[model samples]
Target: MTSRPTPRRAVLTAALAVAAAASPFASATPAFAGASGSGPGPAEGAVDHRAWATFPQWSAGRGAGTRVIGGTRPGLVIGDPIGTHEYRDPHTGTTAAWEYATWLSPVRTLPAPATEVVVSFNARTPAGTWLQTELRGTYTDRTRTPWYVMGRWTSGDAAGDIRRTSVDGQGDGKSSVSTDTLAVDNPASGLRLASYELRLTLYRRPGTRLTPTVWRLGAMASDIPDRFTVPASRPGEGAGHRLRVPRYSQEIHKGQYPEYDNGGEAWCSPTSSQMVIEYWGHRPSREDLAWVDPAYADPQVCHAARHTYDNQYKGCGNWPFNAAYAATYPDLQAVVTRLRSLNDAERLVRAGIPLITSQSFLASELEGAGYGTAGHLMCVVGFTESGDVVANDPASPSNAAVERVYRRRQFENIWLRTKRHNAQGEVRNGSGGICYLYFPLRPTTRQARALASVGVR
Candidate 1:
């Protein structure tokens, strides 16, 4: 029910490329391999998701003024500022000089030729700092494209921070980036992304000791053929199990915070995010909710809406932004990724992880939903003994009504299918199994195995 105006911006060509230090500074972090490959290789399957998340992977990558931090969670941090450059925050029309450093990931050749790529990140950006994610890729024909800015993000909404958002107009004719996704302009032209590299630039106000630590950086490359339906997989593992996840309904917040996407249904994305975030024992403190009206119950839901609202998209539903918001809490890590099947989702639930999933459907398509949505987010906490989806749906009239059970066949098709018809019978796009996964900096042994099983370690 939430829509936004096209984000218009003056061409922001902030190319203050400060070269990384050219010397090798040695360290003793146990660099691990890439999020051990899954889905399939370059010539098979419809999806290939790869990420550089461990110390060894970050170590394998070339970094300038960056250091590898090893602990329960191995990550990259800015050790030194390579140079200083002035950046103009496009949204605020403000400019400032900032010290920066960078880490470049090794090129990853996809297992399948992909028509689309979506990048997700996990990091904690302090008040005065932020990070930018970019990609440069080779086509199936070996021709290369320029580095496209996927997102320039900060967890803060303060005056000193740059407005966090995905660049609006990044493309090279053959492809274009829409929000968080990079799409091939003409998939029929027989061109696809074969390999790509990720560049992470860390920035902090000049001469400050503050730095950003990135725990995970990755992309989901997909080439799914357009189909209204997908074959259902046999249910296993997660049936008969459920996690005790808290619930909050977006409908109850109607007209409460219009400045943040007019609240109400527009708050579904962040409402669901907050549920999972709290399930893991984290929440906004009283000080964090101080700005909210004292009469408003569950003030943190309002807090989430404000912090996650993208100045560019003018909405709080930006996928990566929600994931980034979860990572803002200490010791939490989150990523926006695509799961191939319900079986895959079961793996995470088995490991005690609740997923925030995205989908678009008509009221008649998903039984018991009572209403339809062009786009919506809900927490998939578990599966019923009969294999139905047990979800903490935030579309209810109250928190007491938030927990719902959706049919397995109906939920599967709605979540996985990339195409669907509206109530009026017009064709519209679906979310294609997009999900937000959040866990601790150090997960349980079972959680670790479950995460690694889904290629997320």
Candidate 2:
């Protein structure tokens, strides 16, 4: 394990305390084996993919394999960190097996009629290899669907974030990639997301070596019904003061960082990440970001994307991955969670922690955020005196144009609901409320209570 700075250790201790109090699953052990709900179903994968155990009996491959090590962060360690050995049929020489390892999480029950499921991991792998994450679910009647390939992610230049594909039901790395995020959408078929499990597979090319490690894994299921609605809420506690968060615009890097997903136009996540990190007084050093162009302003934004990239997912906006990257710095703590409402956001800001949120809204729906996006990320720094939202929107044409105040009701509609376009151009079902909390240290007791009440741990 890498040694943490003294200040970081203090933060970790406090974070642990907070988690112990706030999270019911904090110290619970993951069952590791997937579960199948009642009903007649097909047999599941036989290989035991439990983390930290000896490798399972596969179609091929040899050696002792790896072990799952425990720490402030627990991860698997591959004994054979380098080298490529193809395990194939001796008779045909057709490559039957490539070097790989798998881990499956215990099954989780999803909200009924879930239209889409989002899975994320906090992982670090050597430069060449990629991590493939898959999700498979069982219906209430016990019918099992084939494994849905969520994404494949390699570190640095090869990361592919948010990959969706039509899977061939095979657990190998050859599944086709798609732009869709839905894993199981059978509203008419009578199949609802009952119980689902996750699998991680590692892949590497010949002549390359590096062990891959995963720190944390998470997934969430959303129904995203055809219509959208949000319940009424009481006033936020901190309805007046806005934090002085530094702004960075994704548009400024539009043409640059092409190695990433089309540069700044798709860089809302990284730009928002940069704003919060800078607000906490830690900037990546020149040597740290030496690979980026010296001519570009705020090169750290690009640096953030590179480090947060998932080779298989093919994008840089993985929620937990970005939060994990921020925690790399000293005295910083970050976690990805869904906030029930803006009152949850207000508590964090009141505690001096800025939030990075994800949403999809039309240009006309959100005032001051010029332009519509199928998806985007921005920082929620604070609230106006009358309970409006204060944000650093990186989608602006320039950095100076990034700060904006948005009306409370309108902002909530965009932030918390799922939506689709109707025939008359009306937006429906806008239900998405995902955010990451970035903080320098523990907040006051009252602030922590508020954060805890809103599920912000």
Candidate 3:
């Protein structure tokens, strides 16, 4: 029997209310050092910047330890450096450590009709030491005479591995953590908040030698209502965006070309492009896989062009990879400018397109069962009222079974890596101007058949 799609609108509504009730006033403001103004939100097709606040500056600790803020410190740094640590256990002979970092910002009035506030981050084990982290948020009501712990969320990781943690809890403390999912709908106080704080403390077990290094932190604002009900229709239904499946029949197995398998060439973009061509029947004139490599790939060589393409992908492609790819593009300034244009979620909604993509091999072990290490792609067909995204992942083996529903924040972080910023500063592979492709929902029967022939339905 086929599994039924979850009623997202109802689920999101219920989840939001539950979250609000559970964790009443967990605080979140903005990032440190970054001022909160009406700047654009995250770039289009990229993760939205949920809140604005100050960075949790590492205050002086008791013992002698180095404190670094806004930048990297060499070694033995105290407090939170990217939210992880390595410390000597004074009590036991074993080396002890913790991963703790906080993002604090001042609260302006809450967004209109917003029933709750949420916080999210990414935690990973650098050296595979048994590690666990907790997500804590604090909120202080400025109006109240004496500040109180308005709300808090305490939950463990969803999957039991050490790769990373994504925590989502409501004001009432209904939360879960997982490796490749975005945790959202955490409830903060309904009262106007003066300040918000996020903290993570990581420490080694009773007997372990591994130190922790934090990779990413992703947080956002959400509109989880106070009551459970179906969500209103989206702003531009049937008017702007539509889904379209393609048509093609080509037998292209994974290992058909030894050069692709042996890494003789960078196959990520081309392979994806080929999938698009085969699935959609739109082949580019330039058959040579290396056609655009010289002008677009190789960050060291094609810097400016790469940035332009990256920016174009985000601003025009309306896909997350567009913004993500800017991270690797040669020209940093171009990337910044492109990213700046997409500053808010409203703009993305206006675009009438939802960016969708996927990652592979990173969390294969945790992806239930039967799914393979080969990564895949799909579009977010729509959002359910319950704060879940309706996704169309074409590569999954089952047809008609292509549609999936996921928690909004969890899906965003897992698919887009919103929490983990790229340190190497490389363009994301799926961004436009490379291998990524976009299609509307309305398609001819032939196109649909072709898509079905492959794994995309």
- The C-alpha TM-scores of every prediction are 0.89, 0.69, 0.33
lDDT of 1 by residue, 215-274 (tens): 889987776544577678788899988899999998888889777877788889899999
What lDDT score belongs to each candidate, Candidate 1 first? 0.79, 0.57, 0.28
Residue-pair clashes per prediction, in order, are: 6, 30, 59
Count of backbone collisions in candidate 1 = 6
Give one digit per residue, the lDDT tens place, for model 3 in 1-457.
Answer: 1111111112122344334334332233212111223322222121122321112423321212223334432112224334345544222234544444332323333332222223332222333332232233333333222211211111111232232212222233332222211123233334333223333344433234544433222233223223211122233322233334321111122223332231111122222222233333333334323334443322211211121121111111212222222222111100111111111111222233233344332233224223332233344445554545555554333334545654554444334321121224321211110112233234356433322221122
Model 2 accuracy (lDDT, Cα): 0.57
Q: Please give the distance, in angstroms, between residue 220's alpha carbon in candidate 3 and its true position after superposition.
A: 1.1
lDDT at 174, model 3: 30
Cα RMSDs, all models: 8.5, 12.6, 17.1
Of the candidates shown, which would achieve the greatest TM-score relative to the real structure? 1
In candidate 2, which residue ranges exceed 4 Å CA deviation? 1-64, 79-98, 110-113, 158-180, 188-190, 202-210, 224-226, 280-282, 306-337, 420-431, 437-457
Using TM-score as the yardstick, the better of models 1 and 2 is 1
What's model 1's lDDT at 205? 88
Candidates, ranked, lDDT: 1, 2, 3
The candidate with the higher lDDT, 1 or 3, is: 1
**lDDT of candidate 2 over 1-457, digit per residue (tens):** 0110111001112222223223222122221122222211111101111111112212122224444666455555454433344533222244522456566666766434343455655566665555667778676567776777665554454332222222232322211123224333323333445667877666554434556666555565543222254554555776896899999988877777555665666678778998999999998987888888888888899898777654334566666567767766655656665555687688778877788887766678787776776667889988988999989988887889888888888888677754444335643333256677776544578656655554333
